[model samples]
Target: MKLTDLDYARQLDREDPLRDFRQRFHIPTNAAGEPVLYLCGNSLGLQPRGVTDALQAELEKWARLGVDGHFAEPNPWYSYHEIFNEPMASVVGARPEEVVVMNSLTTNLHLLMVSFYRPTPQRYKILIEGGAFPSDLYAVQSQARVHGFEPDDAIVELFPRQGEKTLRQEDIEAAIAREGDALALVLFGGVNYYTGQLFDMGAITEAGHRVGALVGFDLAHAAGNVPLKLHQWGPDFAAWCSYKYLNSGPGGVAGVFVHERHLGRADIPRFEGWWGTDPSTRFEMGPRFQPQAGAGAWQLSNAPVLPMAALKASLELFCEAGMQALHQKSARLTGYLHELVTSIGAGAFEVITPAEPEARGCQLSILASGDGELLHQRLMEADVICDYRRPNVIRVAPTPLYNTFEEVWRFWKILEESVS
Candidate 1:
């Protein structure tokens, strides 16, 4: 629909099923105390109002129960991580046994690598996207170094064809076929952090497995933003940070998924710790390490109770408003944003993200012809909180939970003024 069609936009908002959810979050305001059009959920989600109370409960537990809080509290701090499993699994389309909440994103990536990326001399290379996040690049490079392989030789980066902004599935498949025999693992972000392109995970996994390579994903930007089927896709492993689309706070705990098929594989070596030992026998202080079955075996230490509490609160909200419903709203909202940006014409800005709705999440990455940061600064000064990436990209994500159609229209109006 044409973005200038204000009546139609209002009708869309009125018909929006998830519209009521906006009230649940605390939208930030300018010094004048008016609600800011917050389109930065792709970076950091606005905090849900209930999160403070949930966190306070954990604080009260700590204050009242002392050291005994681990086992004696209302939601026992010892098994606090378990509270997140089912809802988290449901969010990602995985079984409860396949998922576990643990440390931060990069840390989980390293731990999953310890078990999944066992590189032999003959098959020592890893495949990743060309412009992967810096943390992912560092982790992959370090993993290669530990395996006695040069990063230059062991890391294969897939790039887009000349003049294209995103990688094609056929190209990704061809690369996997050509290098599959020598590749130990295939790991890519589920959605490109910069370009906002959603990779075909199931197809990618099939192609990688055909050549005997383990497949995994960093779903940091994709987890709650896009629909996922990690278990059905047959990926060997996956990891994600909850801070972005999950609406857990910054530096929030992350989640990992290990397909149940691998649960019984004792040969799969891990960086083991006592927290991963069988819960019933964990207190025995035994010499042997009997890792818990399923993804729980990946746990390195007891979970942080406060973070878990906050996560629990957010996931409960997601559970009440199912991901399917949110995804429906996301598709339309992002489509509307895309339409508005295009209506502004190509000379002012170009969308770097995929054009097809199926190819991306809610994020519409606009590349300004010149002075992108200047335009971004102007938008911020106008109390519109979208984020700017280096060189030229400004990413605006209309989060389904809290953003409205009117806010999206207001963002573009401000953009039009900035560019004019």
Candidate 2:
């Protein structure tokens, strides 16, 4: 049977090992109470069914124990963030000591930059993708300014060659080499948010170190969406938000990774806070700053228990599903979507995201030939939920956790009709 046949899609879903995982999420519905065809996990994932219970448990603890909840039994509020260490480390491929759940994505980026993006008068440049997410660009520009360097001069952006939709690996490596001694920090998105291009992070990290620069990643679009080996890749730092592919609630607590080599070092200049102090010395209220041993040393405030509770729920799901199995299913899901979209023909849309699975995650950015927003509106009206970027791109991610082949087939039907 052809891929376009509805039964064929259904058959694939029936055979999928991860199909049962779909019921674990709270699928959003339409006016008729039918589940919407959701293909936007790259932006915001569906809420896990367990989130309600996870949050209520914390709320009850707050009410029952009040101030004592901080040290109370059964997931004490004080050390709540510590629970994420092993699970989150497994998601991003790092040691527990190297990972910490902390401030929001951009906030963690700025904090990590304080210790990693140290710029000298001679080597003060920062390199990033040309169309990086706005928040990352803003943070890097502001950092350049604070260090007494002009943003235009200090910031170097890598763009794809003319007519190309994504940057070539060689071009990225060459750019890092060209910067040579002048490069201070090489920060790039683990996956580009707009084009859905996954950069060669390991190669990028190696090149940055060769030039005597620190390297880091803004993994907002990557953490739970892709299989990452942060410890093996060995970037100086990395940060990611939990709300997207992780299926945590909106504005959820973010995560950070600091290479173990950088932890427990006194020479590194970090923005100190009470929470970053050693737990033994923390209650002592000492005047001196005695830093924590690992990534927790970057924390400026105590754990946000409410948001962390939500994150804990999602991370538990990830641990249960296993990243390896999730990734395998993601490739098949996105691959099927790609095949369906390509069949719609070049007259309607062109996929800007890389064709290779290794070079991307679950997202496929369709460069529409006509009004992209109008197409987006049509999809919304049909109860097909996806996101449209400015200009001509419509990004759809067939996430493995909840989305299925049948949904991909239905989305193509709607997209084909809308384009015609």
Candidate 3:
């Protein structure tokens, strides 16, 4: 169906299995009190309706039980994190033992690097994408400095060829092969935050392993938005935040994945804490540290029950909707947005996100030739919410879970009016 046809959009919405899911979120309205056509799920997702009750239940538990809340039935604070195992594992395509919901995104990256990015004199360099999220860049640079190597000398950054916006898997593979034994780790975003380009993670993981390097991904934009097979892809470690595509509220708890092979390895170095100690003998106050099995061993402190309760609520929705179903709807939603926007702004804007559906998730990055922020403000004033970058790019995300086809059509009309 043609993207410009309102009936086509309405028809798709009517037929959509997940259409009712949008009503479950509290979408923000504009200054005039109209519901803003929000397309910023890539930054922060809308809050779910069940979040208030979930948080209140934990508050009541804390008030009534005091410290004894740790042992409460149904959702004991002591074992609350365990409930996420099955659902989270299913989302990332990993074994239950391999996944654990824990600290924030960058914090988990730093923690995982403690164990995985072990650099020897011969294998001391780290390879990464050129324009990674600033947090990952800072984390890796500081890691190199902490290990007594100069950041410039120990880091290898791969950039796109002269005139391209996205990366080629071949270029990444070539860099991994060329680095050989000097490479200690390969870290890239599963989806680039700014460009919204998804990488070939399986191929990158293979290339890193071929050169005896550990591989990991920052899946802030990719996880929950796209289907992942972290265990099958065989990356050594990975981390992501739940605030974006996961609909878990602002600064929601993040998660981690450790390959089962690394679960019980004593030789791997890590920054340990009391919570990560073996649960069987945890309260015994044993002198020696006995790390728990699986990714739970990486925990440094007790779980944050309030935020985790909020996460649990959103995850219940994802588990019900299923990632495969979400992804299929996401492709259709994003493709329609792409077609309509391109047709309307043909000579003025170019799509920088990859055209291939497999190489992207729900976002589309449009590179405009004029005042980016002014255009963004125009959209904002019109209640068509989106975000733009420093130079000349605006990013729009039509999230499958909460966004509608009619919203995408409205955004196209607003862009036409704003640029005209």
Task: Report the C-alpha displacement of residue 108, candidate 2, in angstroms.
Answer: 0.6
Q: What TM-score does candidate 1 reach?
A: 0.98
By lDDT, the better pick of 1 and 2 is 2
lDDT of each: 0.92, 0.94, 0.92
lDDT of 2 by residue, 251-280 (tens): 989999999999999999999999998987
The candidates, ranked best first by lDDT, are 2, 3, 1
Tens digits of per-residue lDDT, candidate 1, 129-168, equal 9999989999999999998999999999999999988999
Best by lDDT: 2
C-alpha TM-scores of all predictions: 0.98, 0.99, 0.98
Candidate 3: what lDDT? 0.92
Positional deviation of residue 88's Cα in model 3 after best superposition, in angstroms = 1.1
N/CA/C clash count, model 2: 0
Lowest lDDT 10-residue stretch of candidate 3: 341-350
Candidate 3 wrong stretches, greater than 4 Å: none
Over the stretch 1-420, how does candidate 3's per-residue lDDT look in tens digits? 665988888888999999999988898987777799999999998899989999999999999999999998869999899999999998888999999999999999999999999999999999999988889899999999999999999999888999998888999999999999999999999999989999999999999999999999999999889989999999999999999999888999999999998999999999999999988899998888799998999999999999999999899989999999999999999998888887874677889999899999999998887888888989888887789887899999999999999999889888989888
